[model samples]
Target: MAQLIRTPKQLGVVIRNAHARSGLTQQALADLVGTGQKTVSRIENGHDGTRMDTLFAIIAALDMDLQLGPRSKGGKDISEIF
Candidate 1:
């Protein structure tokens, strides 16, 4: 499946879902990413104020990849969904 997440909130949703799909608890993923469970919870809840390194670590821990393309064609591209 493919999800085009534009905002941090949507990215959080995708991470949460991916974590769920991986059958790992927040703490487990946190361990894999060398972070705390609370931090993972914060990320999943759409509080995206964390550092970019942490974000990338979370994404990598979940076996996910990021793809960036040219900006959307319209004023607001809601096509960015998880």
Candidate 2:
């Protein structure tokens, strides 16, 4: 499922939800991410200081893909205009 994330907090919610869906505890996810549980907690809570590498690792751990595309405007995909 592609989620449109516009803010760090929104991203955090997505990650937290994905983590729950994967049935992994925070500590377990932390272990998989090679980070501390506290770090995972901070991430889940939308800490904006997270490093890109760590964020990517967490996304990978949850089997989630990060994608970049043209931003939709007025709830319409820009690609649709062409």
Worst 10 residues of 2 by lDDT: 73-82
> Which segments of model 2 are wrong by more than 4 Å?
75-82
Estimate the Cα RMSD of every predicted model relative to the unseen true structure.
3.1, 4.6
Residue 81, model 1, lDDT: 30
Q: Which lDDT tens digits does candidate 1 get at residues 9-69?
A: 8888999999999999999999988889999999898896888888899899888898887
Ten consecutive residues with minimal summed lDDT in candidate 1? 73-82
RMSD of 1: 3.1
Best by TM-score: 2
Give TM-scores for every candidate, taking all chains together and pairing residue i with residue i.
0.84, 0.86
Regions more than 4 Å wrong, model 1: 75-82
